[model samples]
Target: MTRDLLGRHRAVLPEWLALYYENPLEITHGEGRHVWDAAGNKYLDFFGGILTTMTAHALPEVAKAVSEQAGRIIHSSTLYLNRPMVELAERIAHVSGIPDARVFFTTSGTEANDTALLLATAYRRSNTILAMRNSYHGRSFSSVGITGNSGWSPTSLSPLQTLYVHGGVRTRGPYAHLDDRDFVAACVDDLRDLLGHTRAPAALIAEPIQGVGGFTFPPDGLYAAFREVLRERDVLWIADEVQTGWGRTGEHFWGWQAHAHNGPPDIVTFAKGIGNGMSVGGVVARAEIMNCLDANSISTFGGTQITMAAALANLNHALEHDLQGNARRVGGLLLERLRAVAAQVPHVREVRGRGLMLGIELTRPGTDEAAPEAAATVLEEARAGGLLIGKGGGHNTSALRVAPPMSLTVAEAEEGAAILERALRSI
Candidate 1:
């Protein structure tokens, strides 16, 4: 049955849509942190469907809200006064840290970012954008144009003249040997040097932690340092918190807070996990930036009633249950356990992340070269052992990505780590 469905899918779906493993399995249903395939195989879910399932699978509150809202209304365009949309917007604004903020909803992160670009370019009256060196935003033409990762970036042609910046990954860059403070200085120097050569940029966009770039992180306060330089040129700072928002980082609610000593960002774009799979995405900015457009604009399916209902329920449940604390506790334990496992494996270069968003990079035994085959082997072995994980990196895809639900329990973390240890050993 799986084989037949796979063949049919391949015949119809775009080839660029990549699948996991040599034999990809179809996930039929899920509950909590586990999912069942079409063939009745149950495996522990760690990637959370690319970190979209912020809570658990089949969350009762969210399901109930969706069902109840559907009974009344699924969608009403932006023209109408949407109670759920307004309520969610109020909650988001309260937590956004931007004073006198305005929110605009979109169906996906790509659109939210596109909205951000429109705002920044119009406000600053500049078309130039600065993006990080190894980052992946989305597949849309506008998003891809700013993306610096060569593997994911399909084209160099773009309406926005995007210039790539440094300091996304600290472990393997030109200044890898430097200490943390020196590394920050070097990146700032690079930024200042670049700013001197080009026209004033409208905005400098970045992911707090590069998700698709092997979950790599820069030294703390890297962005804050760059903020000083960008501010001199009147450049807007846009934080792409699609993966790092809502306390997934253990220490910060929004990833931008890591660099908040300077001041809040001018604009913030968020999606993924906010709706817990309900397709909620939006941008929050000071009224001045969001209202820069002279004419009217609306997102047809942006804040539809059903999705807003789900988002409200999901947000309340996540906060009320203190899932963020759970992520900090369980995820800390899991990270330590994985580090111990990595000490025994030569190919395991590093284990990095915060909260549930974790990654294990595999490299050649004695060299800096990434070991993609080893990553593939561990993924297949983990699946055989009843575990589901993910793989990501810039060019070689050599890092095992493990971002389970924020509500992951300690026992589940232990079990998942044990299975992952065996997978690493097998590799």
Candidate 2:
């Protein structure tokens, strides 16, 4: 059955669409932190559907809410006043940390980011955009234009003029040798110099933690320093929190809070975990920037009652259970365990990230060269050991991205870590 499906999938899907493992397995269903494959094999899930399964899989609260809402009204054009939408908006606005904020929902992170770009360009009256080096926003035409990762970006023809800036990966870049403070200062100086040569840009969009660029991040307070410069030139700061929001980073509810010494950004975009597998993405902005468009715009399927109900339930569950606290505690222990494993392995170059969003960067035995083959072997071996993980990195997909659900238990973390240790050792 799986073989037949695989053949059909290959025939129908685009060749560029990537699949995992030596033999791609079909996931049938899921519970809290585990899933069953078509062959009736159960695996402990660590990546959680690219971290979209925020709380848990098949959560009763979210399932019940979806069922109840769909019975009444699933969707209506954005013409009438949506009570559920308004209620979710109120809830998000209160927690978004942007003063006098307005929320606009979209179907995915790509659309949310596209909406943000539209607003920022119109308000600043410029088409030029400054994006961090090795950052990825989304896959839409507008989003692709601003993406700096050459591996993900396919074309150079775009509507906006994009300038890639320095500072997303602190350990792999030109200024890796400097201390944290000096690194931040050098990046700021680089930003200042770039701004002088280029025309005024509409905004500087960045991911608080670069997701597809191997879960890399800049030094803390780097953005606050850059914000000081952007503010003087009227350039908006847009934080793309698609993967880092909703307390995935442990210490803060939002990734931008790491740089909140300056203030909240002019715009913030989020998705993935907000709906717990349901499609929910949106942008939050100050009233001034959100209301910049002269003409009216609305998403026909955005903020529908069904998705709002799912998101509301998921948000409540996350907050009520203090899943963020779990992420901090369990994730800390998991990180320490993985670091110990890496110390014993010579190919593991660095283990980085906070909270549940951790990554293992594999390299050659004694050199800095990326060991993509090693990563591939580890992934396959992990699957064989009844564990599921993910891969990412600008360097030939050489990093193992481990982002389990926020509700992960310490026992499960230990199990996943042991499986990963054996997988790495196998390679």
Candidate 3:
């Protein structure tokens, strides 16, 4: 049955849409941190549907809200007044650190980033953008232009003149040998030099934790230093929180908080997990920047009633249950366990990330070359051992990404860790 579906999927889906595992398994249902395949084989879900299922699988609160809203009205477009949309926006604005903020909804992260680029360029009167190396923003044309990961970029032609910067990935860059303080100085110096060479960039957009870049991040306060530099020339800062928002980082509610000494970013874009599966994405900016455009703008289906209802319930439940605190407690334990196990394996080069968003990078035993084959092997072995994980990296795809739902339990973490350890040992 799975084979037949796989054949149909390949025939219809784009070739670039990659699937996990040597033989893909069909998930039939899920509850809590576990999922069952079509064959009824149970597996601990460590990836959480690419970190989209933020709270848990089959979360009752979100499902109930979505169902109730669908019964009343699914979508009325942005032409009508939306109570749920206004409520969710108010809550998000209060939580967002930006002063005098306004929100605009989109259907996906790609759309959110695209809106951000449009605002930045129109406000600053420049089309050039500064992006970080090894960063992955989204798949849209504008978002893809800013993406620094070569593996994800499909075309060289882009609408924006993008200049890639350093410091997003701290471990494998040219300045990796430097200490934390020196590393910041070097990256800042590089940024200043790059700015000197290029036209004034409209903005510098970055992911607090480069999600598709294998969960890599720079030293804390690295962006703060860059903020000071960009502030002098009025370059807007955009924080892409699609993967690191809602306290996934454990230490802070938002990933940008780790570098909040200067203040919140000028524009914040979010998606993934906000609706707990519903397609909800948005951008938050100060009213001045948000309203710079002279022409009218509206996302016809962006702030639909049903998605807003789902996002409101999901966000409320996450806040009420203190899922951020749960992530800090449980994810710390999981990270420690994975680090201990990784030390015993020679191919595991680095185990990094915060909160529930963690990554284990695999490389050849002696050389610095990436071991993508080892990552693939471990993914398959973990699946066979009744655990589901994900893989990502630079061009090689050699990093194991383990980001379970924020509401993970201690017992579930241990079980997933054991399975992952055995999988790593197999390689």
Model 1 error, position 277 (Å): 0.9
Candidate 1 Cα RMSD (Å): 0.8
What TM-score fits each model?
0.99, 0.99, 0.99
Q: Candidate 2: worst 10 consecutive residues by lDDT?
A: 76-85
Quality of model 3 by C-alpha lDDT: 0.94
**Which residue pairs collide in model 3, if any?**
none
Q: Which stretches of candidate 1 lie over 4 Å from their true place?
A: none
Task: Compose the digit string of candidate 3's lDDT tens values, residues 102-132.
Answer: 9999998989999999999999999999999
lDDT (Cα, tens digit) per residue for candidate 2, span 252-289: 89999999997899999999999999999999999999
State residue 358's C-alpha deviation in candidate 1, in Å: 0.9
For model 3, state the Cα shift of residue 44 in Å: 1.0
Task: Score each candidate by Cα lDDT.
Answer: 0.93, 0.93, 0.94
Model 3 worst lDDT run, 10 consecutive residues: 388-397
